[model samples]
Target: MLRPVVVGLDGSRESLTAADWAAREALRRGLPLRLVHAADAPAAGGSDLPELSAPRHWARRILRDAMDQINERYPRLYLSAEQIARPAAEALVSAGGAGELLVLGSRAFSGFGGFLAGSVALQTVTRVERPVVLVRADQTVEDEHTPDPEGRPSADTPYRAVVVGVDAVRPAEQVLAFAFESAALRSTPLRAVYAWRLPMVRAVAEAGAHQTEEAAARRALTAALAPWREKFPTVEVVEQAEEGHPAQRLLSAAQDAGLLAVGRPIRPARLGAHTGPVAHAVMHHVRCPVAIVPHE
Candidate 1:
């Protein structure tokens, strides 16, 4: 059976937005869409107030409403909804097992304030092996598309490039593959960004060595992407080497990108879900959708 694209729904605007994004992605991949809700069970020894059951009812209602919207939007798309009695993170991770991709929503802060990804999103992204994408509540389809040359809004505009962070010395194949595939799917260019700065202690020793360092970084990125280029011959690949923080570079590159792809090394369950600094930074700051891919 084909794996479906799963999305976690909590009735929040963020979640609804993610569901819509997932629906469009499902259509693009020709996969089914599954909406999941994790309703926290009532606490034990709690008073049997008549309103106690309202939580369960609300959860079901959320699922129903989301299903209706998605069904109406993608009438031909196969969709299903389920409400599980468990922690949100646990429910999402379990559902992710059978999913081709798992999507969750995030709420962006106002002004220059940073957004919060919530613990559920953090936990799910770290634990799930499948690629998990986080979409901000205010994101629109047009946000993923490029603006007209004259800076006017137009639906006919093509999508912006797909940006992927690369660790030249230790590039992750899973991350590279996903980035290339996304660019190919959208018929957009792929910008592979590698960020590096000489260690403080080596700064003096490496003085006037910026050119050599940049050359090496570029070569590393090119070599790492060689196989993928062959696999995706049509994708226009751009290699960018920047001397700065990886997270900052990626965030800047993603300003106009349709999607930003990053990798999180999978650790044993006992180690817990560590998102690492770079992935953690972008998940909260990037304007575009962020795909957290787990690699061995």
Candidate 2:
């Protein structure tokens, strides 16, 4: 099983923005966003305080309050929060797991105000095993518009250039639907890269032969997506059959991509409840933020 989605919220403006982004995404993907608030609880009561009196237990309560306030605004969002005695980034990193997408809002950590980029966000994004999205507090999302060769708006983001990894197993159809819609939203181009390697076939020697395989792969991919393409005629499509590891091909193709979408296939024996080879590698190596559509 892929792990769950989690977002870190520390009651800061950036954290709140992160919460908003996470909530909206969870709603879109029909998944729950685990909102977390790690607080600093005093290890021991101050010596000055009278021993007979009870110390205030506020850390856990504070977390609950923040979570409640968030849920009130996004009532439909399924969220849960708890307090723990650890650094906020560490708390978030600990929550990372299979299928989980970690999101953080950007801002400086010093004296109450600065730019959106923060050390915590950077650390989480760079180190996590699953996908991490570092969103600016002021990040305003807009629909993608493909520009023509002359740099003009094309067909409302053409649903073109949608890419998906196909291994004929585990990844659900819902992932495909998301890829199609995302491409349609951008009206850009559509391409799929399925990397494969045979034990005896040396790939470096057959770059030309791989071109033919790429063509055939395109046909197979088209056949699979035939219904969707017929339904949305404006969407252009392409496919790549590369002779290498699946993960490397995906990372290479996604380097200049607007959006990279992948499926978290069912847990494999070796992968241990994680996204398959391609998605896992992309999550770490790609410079672009990826949309990990869990094969739910």
Candidate 3:
């Protein structure tokens, strides 16, 4: 059986945006879409509030409304809805195991306040084995495509390049494969960005030594991506090595990207936060959709 694209919905505008993004992705991948809503368990003695007393009913309504809107937009798409009686993060992480891709919504923060991914979004991304895409509340299809020459909207605009952050010293195969495959699927270029910085002790060593270090970094990145480039011959690959912070460079590279892919080291829930600082930063700040891929 083909795995379906799953999305967590909570009747919030952010979640609705995620559903929209997931629907398009499902259609692109020729997979079914599953919408999941987690209804929190009622209070110890059962509260007097109607919503708390009938949590399932409220969840069903949220799902129904979402299903209706998605159905109207994609009548031919196969869609299903379910309600789980558990905490939102737990429900999403469990559902993610059986999904090809799990999508969640995050509200965009204004100015430099940073994003609010919520506890559920952060926890789910850290724990899920599959790739989890976080879509901003205001993200739209047009944002994923390149603008026309006249700077006007057009349906025929091609998608922007797919950007992937790589740690040359410890490249993740899963992350590289996902980036290459996504670029191939969209028939777009892949930008592999690897950022490095000279240690403080080595900053004033020598000019020639600095050049050698830079060369070595570039070679490492090339070697790391060689196999993936062969695997995806049709994908145009652009390798970039910059001397700076990884997160800062990635943020710069993602300015014009359609999707940014980053790797999260797989860590057991008991070990606390698993997402690295770079992945966490990009997920919250990148304007385009962000894909958090888990790898061992």
Candidate 4:
């Protein structure tokens, strides 16, 4: 069963946007929305006297006001929030044990930033067990300043498109199902993308051999997805097969997407240098909101 979608709020603009998205989403799904804020206790500053940071106290109070605003603005949304005396990621991870989805807002941590996501957003995406959603709060506000390239309001979505990234993994079925369900709800088309890179590039000898192998690869990919297509016949399946890095291809496909869904293994091994390559890449580049699916 899908559990509640939990969002992390650190009283930043990003968190607020994340909260707004989560609220609307939870209401649409008839699911409860859990808003979590983690406030760190003031550290001792050399002198023995424990300094009571007024800002810390005020932060907790701000959460109450924020929650109230959500309650008032989204009357139909089921919303609740909690504050912990720990880091944001830890608090959210603990909450994720029972969460169906975890969401965060991307911030620019680099003081001299040109482009990139903040540490907290990136770390949460890598470490969280459940599927996580990252919102680009920086763009949400800045987008207002620039003229719309699409020549329409950024929020002017007559409909939302559901996009999913699939590879050769068995877990992809879960991701596809989640995307189909979402598309069904929104009555939008479900675009399925399967990115590939020939593992044995050096094996091919002839120039025409590459085309032959590419056709075979595409055929095999379609055969794998046939079962799901048979099941959700109404779902408009837009298949894409490209030769490039999995992450890069997936992100490119998601650029015009409303929601991008990817699957996670049931048991994720402890993240070493870089957990899984595909998901890591998607977390960094995909501009739209991302939904992660976890297997039972």
What's the CA error at residue 104 for candidate 2, in Å? 6.0
Off by over 4 Å in 4: 41-56, 108-115, 138-151, 154-157, 169-171, 199-204, 264-275, 294-296
Model 2 TM: 0.51
Count clashing pairs, candidate 4.
Answer: 0
For model 1 the local lDDT of residue 44 reads: 84
In candidate 2 the C-alpha lDDT for residue 144 amounts to: 24
Per model, state how many residue pairs clash.
0, 13, 0, 0
- lDDT of candidate 4 at residue 102, scale 0 to 100: 81
Candidate 4 lDDT, 1-296, residue by residue in tens:
55787888877787788787777677767888887877765565623443555656676776887799789878877677787777766777777657877878775435622124566655566567667776766544223122357665555443456888777444366677778777776667877777666656544655666677678767866876788778877877777877777677787787667788887655535533233666656665666677766554
Assess each prediction's global lDDT (C-alpha) against the native: 0.89, 0.59, 0.89, 0.69
Ranking by lDDT: 3, 1, 4, 2
| Residue 237 accuracy (lDDT) in model 1 | 96
Q: Please identify which of the two predictions, 1 or 4, would achieve the higher lDDT against the true structure.
A: 1
Per-model TM-score versus the true fold: 0.93, 0.51, 0.93, 0.80
Higher-ranked by TM-score: 1 or 2:
1
Candidate 4 local distance difference test against the native: 0.69
Q: Tens-digit lDDT track for model 3 on 191-256?
A: 999998888677676667678788999999999999998899999999999999999999999998
Each prediction's RMSD to truth: 2.2, 8.2, 2.2, 4.6
Candidate 1 local lDDT, 1-296, one digit each (tens) = 99999999999999999999999888878899999999776788776787988888899999999999988988999999999889999999999867998999999967742356998888899889999999999888777788898997665788789999998899898999889988988889999999988766566676667777778887888898898999999999999988999999998898888899999999887877788899999988887889998888
